[model samples]
Target: MGLPGEMRVVEISGPGGPEVLVPAVRKVPQPAAGEILIRVRAAGVNRPDLLQRAGSYAPPPGASDLPGLEAAGEVAAVGAGVSRWKVGDEVCALLPGGGYAEYVVTPADHALPVPEPLGMIEAAGLCETFFTVWSNVFERGRLTAGESLLIHGGSSGIGTTAIQIARARGVRVFVTAGTEAKCHACLELGAEMAINHREADFVAAVKDATGGRGVDVILDMVGGDYLPRDVRALAPDGRLVMIAHQKGAEVSMNFSLVMVKRLTITGSTLRPQSVEAKARIAEGLFREVWPLLDTGRIAPVIAESYPLEQAAEAHARLESGQVAGKIILEVA
Candidate 1:
């Protein structure tokens, strides 16, 4: 795998909207030890990319500064100490950043084989959302069989992943989406009940769905005001794993609710986590979830794909908050 001279990338010139993503050509990257170079076929567009564009979320220390976090393609080359994968292996990876380009370098351990059942586009869309949900909701939150899991934004990438993974594990799911249509989409994907947050109070609806017992775990992306209602909606010993603070991070909430229910609150970002920590999660996912993908029990729901040159449009679509599932960019 001889390295190419240069690769085309969609880059953010400065802090601003989607229009700020400008196309540029840069020297192809060389993989460091334990890293692999991928000929990027496609990249996933996520909310964090939008935030990075606005200068709200910067790349974690030592991670790539470019925007895309998930991508799928073939391993064109491998660096020293990379024994598990070789050149020409079809792989998809959860990149820390630098995916909105023709080629991106990633730690070989973060790369997973794309199942033959899933095409490159769908594989491109899996890494970020599935890794996030598997780590936060199941691994950390401890969602169990016969237990109930509540997910916010049920039609978004993470929401959709949580729904399928929980369902496959025999856990009942309740999700909140913005519209009846989105709610119905969640139901079709296996949620026990889909609440239209705009038309009904999710707290009451969740209670009703569980016979007033409340859900066992909640995977929340909305912070601030949702914190209180999330507490009210928990079952005894339940967990609320907050992943993002889209509504805002600060909140005034009662501690008694947390104490009375014996609730646990925790969250983590993949980029900032130590490599050893992520490697642990990757192992768990490999043992429990990878087989599902191998057998087709779980797969990514790709809502749309845009060309690399149209990267700005992909960001704009994500900002609209109307995408049914993961939106991806084709690097070619």
Candidate 2:
């Protein structure tokens, strides 16, 4: 099949609000060696995308300035030296950038086959959150089966995925969300208890839930004052993985707790990592988490979707902080 010369994309006209994302046409990118061209069907809207749109996060060198980080689609073309996939194969992938377009090129190894029971739309929401949760909650945090985990932002895409995946692996999951409805949604998705952060003290709740021993690991996206509480909420040798600082990055926390408890503090951002590193993460997911998705033990929670042109409105919805899960853009 012949490829189209031009494709539609959502571009950041200027760094500002969601209204800056405007539709425009651009030449379809050709995949280079070790890369594959994907005819994008859907793209996920993430917090990083919002940061990029607002000029707080810049795309790394050689990455497209477009604002999407993950997408699902069919392979449209294969570049030289690529072997795992060919035209017409369905895939969901983590991208360095450029997922907002109708066609995107990414390292072939970064893409995973769409799970058996999921379509392009749902698969679109899978890569970013799953890869993030796996890398942080399991790999970095070292959360193992039979341990307890505390997840902040439980109603979020990352939180929802982490809750289910951790629960499926025999890890008890506790979560904190901003509202009662969001907390309930987290509980329904396998969280042992969902604390309404706005009303309840998460540190106290976690301590109470774990019999005052504290959780074994915590996946925190809300930084700021929560850092001290997160430190206090961990059991000895517990791991605290920070992925974002929505509340604020700076904090004043007592180091005595960290040292006395022997807690581990770590964090990572997905987009800036090297291709080889991300490919390794993809492999891990293929072996460990994909089966859960295939068997219906876990799944992506889609809050809403918008047409590719209405990317601005989608951003508005996400920024409203009312969404319970992933937001997506339907491209094809």
lDDT of 1 at 188: 91
- Clashing residue pairs for model 1: none
Question: Which one wins on lDDT?
Answer: 2
Please give the TM-score that candidate 1 achieves against the real structure.
0.98
Computed on alpha carbons, the lDDT of every model, listed in order, comes to 0.91, 0.95
List the candidate 1 regions with Cα displacement exceeding 4 Å: none
What is the C-alpha lDDT profile of model 1 across 1-332, one tens digit per residue? 36789999999999999899999999898899989999999999988899899999999888777899989999988999999998899999989799999999988988899976998899999889988998999888988899999999899999999999999999999999998789888999999999988889999999998899899999999888998999999999999999999999999998998999999999887777877777777778888998888999888888899999999988988898888899989886
Give me the runs in candidate 2 sitting further than 4 Å from their true place.
none
How many clashing pairs does model 1 include?
A: 0
User: For model 1, what is the alpha-carbon lDDT of residue 291?
Assistant: 89
Model 1 Cα displacement at 282 (Å)? 1.4
Tens digits of per-residue lDDT for model 2 on 132-161?
Answer: 999999999989999999999999999999
